[model samples]
Target: RTLLSARAPVTLISTSGDPPLHIAAERPSAAATLATLIDAGAPLAMRDGRRQTALHIAARAGNSVAVATLLGARCDPELRDRWHRTALHWAVVNGQLGAATLLVAAGATVNGVPMPIKKHLKKTSLPLEAPLHSAARLNPASGAQMIELLLRAKADPNLRDQFGQTAMQVAQGAGWSPAQLSLAWEQQYVHGLDYLRAGSNHSR
Candidate 1:
């Protein structure tokens, strides 16, 4: 409050690459603190060391209230982090379905692909990835729910990652049986065959 009253630059980056807003957004009691910062003219779009915005931090922390506050503040849900992953990707990867849902409702692209990192940022080339790929590869236990949410939001079931594999293929390679995928699909979309047919056609 003192610094803010004194007009201290709220956008100053910390050594960890987070701004004050990003740090505050990580806590469950973040709503008041975030609102204060935003009201004090804090820039909501500033990125941390990893290029993650306040919304990304809130999503990764599973802080749905904070995510909602940020969204209400008109933060860009589509902003990408250093890994080219949006808040939706982080939310799905962390199994924060609430946060993912909020992001999806805020117009985050369900099938948006991560941008490839520059060569200097990696020892070897890395491929772009989609939110579904993260859910399938990193959060398979609840990935079906995440997939359902994305699918309901009109995510492309057949969207492939840099590895040239769809989310279902990734799930299958990760030991999710065809039965599991089928059941998950049925649970979300009543006309499951449409999505299945789309996936099959895209693979060809």
Candidate 2:
């Protein structure tokens, strides 16, 4: 009201070019400002300048409250950002089990392909990366834990990224070691469809 009454310019500031309404909606008391974003017709799945949505950030932040707000506001849990990562994908990559659990229970697809990210790799237009790829980059403990969460949600252990790399293959390449990837491979052997058996390099 004060900013409006003073005719002050409304500004949406985000370090990552995040949408202002989206940012507000992810806050502790975001409920206070949701009506405005709703009325203004904020883009439910629209990415900010950086191709990230508020739901994506909320998941990474492990903010269950904000996640519930977004879901209740009718935000699509399956919505993907530029990287093709839904809220659930980000939650898993950020080592947020609770947030990932909420999104998965809300019906986010377990088999949905996760988006990959490279913080400092040579930049390119490639988008074949996924949250699983990102998770595999973490230390063994966190990376392994993320795999467990995704698998529990029914994420396809046999899922191949844009590069045709399964989670097990990617983790192994990222130095997860054969021992760490064993569980993931076993789960795949159990849940993988016939399609998985047909893929090259799929045999355990």
lDDT of 1 by residue, 1-204 (tens): 777778788886678777889989999876787889989888888877778899999999999999999999999988887667789889988999999999999999988754454542473343576787777765455888888888888877667776677777777778776677786666555655555556668778
lDDT of 1 at 87: 90
Query: Highest lDDT: which candidate?
Result: 1
Q: What is the TM-score of each candidate against the true structure?
A: 0.83, 0.67
What do the candidate models score in CA lDDT, each in turn? 0.80, 0.65
Model 2 Cα shift for residue 91 (angstroms): 2.4
Off by over 4 Å in 2: 1-18, 25-43, 113-130, 184-204
Most accurate candidate by TM-score: 1
Query: Which whole-number lDDT from 0 to 100 does residue 141 have in model 2?
Result: 78
